[model samples]
Target: MKPDIHPVSRPVVFRDRAAGVAFLTRSTAHSTRTIEWEDGAVHPLVDVEISSASHPFHTGTSRVLDTAGRVERFERRYGRTAPNRR
Candidate 1:
């Protein structure tokens, strides 16, 4: 463990603009903006478009696509049948 090799991990607030969610975590990332946290402490704030709260996958709003089913349906309609493995 060298003194100069380690990066600082301080509390940073990542705010999701659309979802209105704020995350408090330690990161090396720094910003000029600051905000008062829920605990009455000020921390560096980073504005983000999407976060775990707003992201489709994390929020369970992601669209599930059936690739195999869609391909079969397309082949049947377009009349381009693939070779049967059987």
Candidate 2:
């Protein structure tokens, strides 16, 4: 209810570098950079590394870590150390 204390909610552009996609939506976040949208409206620009466009699961390109390889390397160094052995 206070002026200047409330978050500014306005239209913003989120840019995804990897997927080369730009999205326009409303947000309360602030930014110093600005750009013109496709509709010829100037708005704050937010650069993001990943989004729905480039996200692995979203794009059906998810990658799994090789935990088996890591465990083998670790055991080679520690001689396959056992935990809580009686």
Candidate 3:
């Protein structure tokens, strides 16, 4: 409830280059680039490498890591050791 302390929030356009999608929202982040939104208004354009549109988890394209294979590889590289008995 403080006054003159919060950063200004303005309409900004976040463009996801990989997914080729643009979203209009309010944010404190600033950018030198500008984009004309569908509403015929210019908004600061921020380019992001990845967003929900293209992220593996969000897109359901995430790969399950091969932990078993990794363990085997590590053991091969450094011979497996016997359990340390206290």
Greater lDDT among 1 and 2 belongs to: 1
Pick by lDDT: 1 or 3, better one: 3
Per-residue lDDT of model 2, residues 29-53, tens digit only: 7889999998998999999999999
**Of the pair 2 and 3, which is ahead by lDDT?**
3
lDDT of 1 by residue, 19-57 (tens): 998999999998999999999999999999999899999
Worst 10 residues of 3 by lDDT: 30-39
Q: Give one digit per residue, the lDDT tens place, for model 3 in 4-39.
A: 999999999999999999999999998999999998
> Higher TM-score: candidate 1 or 2?
1
lDDT of 1: 0.93
Q: Could you tell me which residue pairs clash in candidate 1?
A: none
Using Cα atoms with residue i matched to residue i, what is each candidate's TM-score against the true structure?
Answer: 0.81, 0.70, 0.81
Residue pairs in clash, model 2: none
Evaluate residue 9 in candidate 2 and report its C-alpha lDDT on the 0 to 100 scale: 88
